[model samples]
Target: MRKVILLFAVSMALSAGVRSAEELSVDLMQSIEDTNKSLSSNIALSNKQAATADAKELTQMFAQVETFFDHKGDAKNAVDLARQSKELSTDIVGFVAVNNFESATTAATTLSRTCRTCHTFYKKE
Candidate 1:
């Protein structure tokens, strides 16, 4: 009985870990898309405050992406891309904070490119 109880506990723990990992991946991807939309809309409307907020969210999301890829043992190139994208997001945040739409737009473009490049290698069709 004790052995069976132990096995059940271990199984539950493992399942919970798997579920949380899957949820994290889904949440991160959704967050990235949402952040992009928010940033684009805010920039187009010249809403510096909202754009800054969006940039901040993207920056954090990219960091999470980097960590997720690293933990998944993804290719080194993909991990590097994630890290580069995170850096670009930070730049976007800074640019938006200063109301520098031009620089922010450029950085955001680079961020998208990095994401596309990584996705090309790893994302499912």
Candidate 2:
């Protein structure tokens, strides 16, 4: 309950700065990539605090992706993948909170794979 409220507060605060304009997908993707690396490293180190922070940020970023895909309305698969990524991010936060580094690592791996799968379909080569 406390974590959920904190997450909501953090998410709202983070998104507040960008109220002037929605982030371009490219910019958002770059942010996701950078945050993902931090998340993976922190999970490997069993740094719960850092991992949780990164995961929370990722969860928010993937939510943005989900909204982008849903609004585009051309790729249901992308929307699904985005949602899966978001859930995995949240899972990582929970796993790390409990000192379950192995499970957190697994969730992070799946999250990376999910992003790559979406890129295979949507990214221009």
Candidate 3:
């Protein structure tokens, strides 16, 4: 009876663990989707000959990403990457606002790199 109870307890714990992980993964994917939506919107605005609009969208997206990181738990590397990406996005927004396309492009490239790095590690197939 004791052995059966022990086994049942262990199984329950394992089930709960799996549920928690699944929840976390779902939340993370949602965060990524939100970030991607912002990026896409900004890119479209940029291509529409509206640099100011693009910069505003990018800034908002970066803010959402930061908020996502703030709510995350046990994702230290991801949080760090998000922070770095936010800085790059901020730089891009600033440069674009100033009509400095060259510098904005460079900052955007860096931001892309940060996204790729984070995805490669955290986004599993």
> lDDT of each model, Cα atoms only?
0.80, 0.89, 0.64
How high is each candidate's TM-score? 0.79, 0.80, 0.58
RMSD of each: 2.6, 13.0, 5.6
How should the candidates be ordered by TM-score, best one leading?
2, 1, 3
- Cα displacement (angstroms), candidate 2, residue 69, comes to 0.5
Better of 1 and 2 by lDDT: 2
Rank ordering of all candidates by lDDT, starting from the highest: 2, 1, 3
Tens digits of lDDT, candidate 1, 1-125: 99999999999999999877644476678889888878877877779888888878887887887787677674688679888987887888788777788888888778778878887988877
Model 2 lDDT tens row, 56-120: 99999999889877877778998999999999999999999899999999889888899889889
Candidate 1's displacement at residue 103, Å, is: 1.5
lDDT, candidate 3, 35-121, per-residue tens? 545544554455424554554555665566556656666677877887777677667667766666677666666776777897798
The top-ranked prediction according to lDDT is 2
> Which 10 consecutive positions of candidate 3 have the poorest summed lDDT?
43-52
lDDT of 3: 0.64
- Of the candidates numbered 2 and 3, which has the greater TM-score value? 2
